[model samples]
Target: MECAAKGLAGEPCAGVAQRRCGSCGAVAYCSKDHQFVHWRFHKEECARLATQMSRIDVLSQFPFTFSVEPLALNHTLPSMRCLFLESIKVHLKGLWKPECICGPEIASVKDLSITAEWNMESSLCPCTEPENPVTRPLASWEDYYQWRSLPLHSPVAVLLHWPLTLYHCLQLSRIQTSRHDGHATLNIHYLGPEKELLQLAVFAELLALFPGVHLRIELVGPAVPRSRDGEVVNISSYAHCSVQNCGCRSSTAPEDLNSSAVTLKLWKGLYHERYSDIAKDSNPHLVLAPNAGVAAYPSWMPTIEMIREIGIPAIFTDFCEEAAHLASCCISYITGQPLGVPIQINPFRQPIAENNSALYIPCYSNCFVFGM
Candidate 1:
């Protein structure tokens, strides 16, 4: 009997299951799409079923041996992906829980997909800091790519000019999926004072989706007055954090109608250390390193070895492209592949070490998973 796999977006594929996985007939899928979506999820199951169906130790005799990491026995993955992350084992000390990286939550996927606005072959100059950085408008990817090609020096320049890329990445992570518990936590290194306005909008929309909210923020840029040890400010106390100024559609508010429930653990200086200490209370699922080096916190960059150890996917806006390498490593670890031409990169930079792995989306995204 053919093994008809169930599709995540819709109905089960029962059409004469023609594609056979591995040697035995125990696991089969009716279509390539069905097969792709089910692999990481079913790989372990396949091994068990294979033994019952055959006498040949199929995997044992094979040239490849994969030492799998321990996944949640609960199977509460955050997103639905075909090829999930698998890796060699390493350990770290953190109370954080793993989250599934997912695609855009907008009703229309077509709205977010890469558009043909730039020829992509056009010349780009080295990126530099804008004379006035705060009010810089976001650029389309084509223009961003074109500018990044120039002999760019500052990571700050990339952050100033490329808010759209960062915004899309935020959307792609779908970073705010609330658990059934009605609470969720996320971490974003506030890129700058102006960017805080945007972050407020993003967080407001995210918080409105759930009843109770726990926000952990690491503030950067010239916006917040610097304190050496950092400060914890309740966002509700800030006038700009109000629902009206936040520009969100969510109607949920505190009983008083004036106080926001959001909390901001704002800080600066030695972010990785500060962030780690802060994480003890509310473990954040994602980190926003949009600028990468300076405000994005480059010293905090972990080697590919460390990333495989943690088993968490990262979203990068390291306009300088270093974060891309780290992200590429995350993708490679999952697929057991070597780095190559990434699906995308800023113009005029060497490819990051982690390139061309299963972690990549076909265009303009890393760690993308589409679930119905």
Candidate 2:
């Protein structure tokens, strides 16, 4: 005999009395196919019964009454008494909430009162010009409702694979499930001219999915003129941002290589002094100098001819404009342990103090440390 749930060869285990559970014998299985293939019949029932059996299992450990069915199934059971007694109804929804269960709404932030009204004016970064810095402040504790346990929204879930579930939790936290009513509209502000407003709006919708972020879209200045092809012609014609473009997805290589790795060759240059211990085959990470002296080097300082001699596949990106494209390409390939290598001097600089943890490669001066 074997346990259907554990799939371990052993004595027959019964879950629902004579019925054995298809996945785990803690319950019942109608047939092998039903045990493995049919889920529509078992999912909700299993969750409900699992709650009951688990209660029975726990109570059996104590001197309390043997009957745990009421404890498990009752909406007003001991475990749920306080939650039900409370006047406020707590709800969960979105990626985090299943069925968008409605519950009490709670204020998430605190309120501070000013003794009196006063205003101060100061010239600040245009980014700091928003009239209201904080929106959606918590109103009161009356808004909160307690959750009983994890909600069942998906058909299949595993416990040991908690990382997958935890990531889901993080994403679900962003959904204001209680505000599912069509009336709840969020105002967004984008600091650009009218021409670029459409693109910014789409980006903001995506950003809203990030937790702890709220954006208010406001167009800062007049609209910029555009060419017939919908391209902005003048770069500096307006004050608010115009025609902003990024190399985040741009590539110089063929389209097929977008998903593959590219080899990197390390050329020796003024950065050579720092590479003394680093094997020519393995490019050394860089360190930036501080006010200690003139430390700025061209992005191509690492692209010397000697690097290509190593016979490793590599790409050449000397211009700052190309850094984003290069980084995107390399990162996409290195999703897991990758075979190829990439060398670039455009490593962002870390504060000098943070570099204390790593054996510091020498720098031309003292202000910054280049990271690999």
Candidate 3:
């Protein structure tokens, strides 16, 4: 469209447009002075327009085509019968290992109902509002902290405050926003081997999908080599940090999607590889740990901490449900119960679940969160 700039000097800009508003791109300007004059009204309009554009962009990716009744208590893609139904059934659906978590009642893989409302839908945030309304570009953490002095929302709003689980936000591309009240904890169990691979895979996944997000890591647990091979430090080993030695935490965001970091040139790295022998694609969006050593996090700390620390944690362990019998037994550690509890509490109490036993969390591992 032509420039809409008009002024007392001569006339509205019927001239060829020279520039567009950098933020909204809705209006064109033939001259900078005209833009300045129009700024009084255009600024608010620009904010609204930008927000609307962002909403449209977000929805184009995640349409609410699949919303079932009696929503599943657990909210994650791994449990959401959409993307991972078959994957869980095939790779993870094994007989319940008696020692998996705990069970006053029977805890079966079948408890996670295949029939549940799994898709996301559009809705206004359920948080209380200040005189000023909240705008958008999907500020999850901001909303969580805003209205800090206000009373908490109901239990339901607290759970639904931020629904950016790896399964939902990263893999499934579904996210909805709401006001926050209380905190929700995430329990990321790094069960089985491949701990390093899984950790790197998670980091890389976050990097690939959410490069703008920050990743903060606290290295606990003793460093173990990837295998019996040699004494190469595991990626989880704080040795990977540019710093020297123990008690180290690194705050890193995924490499910017547009920027390139170091080249492994994997012969080995997560995104960069030195393996000239192997074919390579351009640097990937994911962060790959160099090839060689990968090990597990300490059982005490669990991998859940790492994921929650990645960005704003969203998914919680066991859907935060309380069993009729296990109320007193429930602990406040938040990452569900600690790694080595006898029974994997909350979700086990659920009649049907999308998560796994505490001992063996398949889809559960991916859906981690940070509590307020």
Q: Could you say which candidate leads in TM-score?
A: 1
The TM-score values for the models, in the order shown, are 0.33, 0.15, 0.22
Off by over 4 Å in 2: 1-372
lDDT of 3 by residue, 275-352 (tens): 121223221111111111111212313233433243332222322212211221222243444322122222111122
Question: What would the per-residue lDDT of candidate 2 be over residues 50-139, giving only the tens digit for each residue?
Answer: 443343332223221212122334354233322322211211211111112132221211211111110111111011112333234211
Model 1 compared with the native: what TM-score?
0.33
User: Candidate 3 has what TM-score?
Assistant: 0.22
**Judged by lDDT, which candidate is best?**
1
Please list the residue runs of candidate 3 whose C-alpha ends up more than 4 Å from where it truly belongs after superposition.
1-199, 208-316, 323-372
Q: Residue 244 lDDT in model 1? A: 34
Q: Which regions of candidate 1 are displaced past 4 Å?
A: 1-167, 174-214, 220-228, 236-253, 256-261, 294-308, 320-372
Candidate with the larger TM-score of 2 and 3? 3
Compose the digit string of candidate 1's lDDT tens values, residues 171-206. 555566344244444444443332332223223322
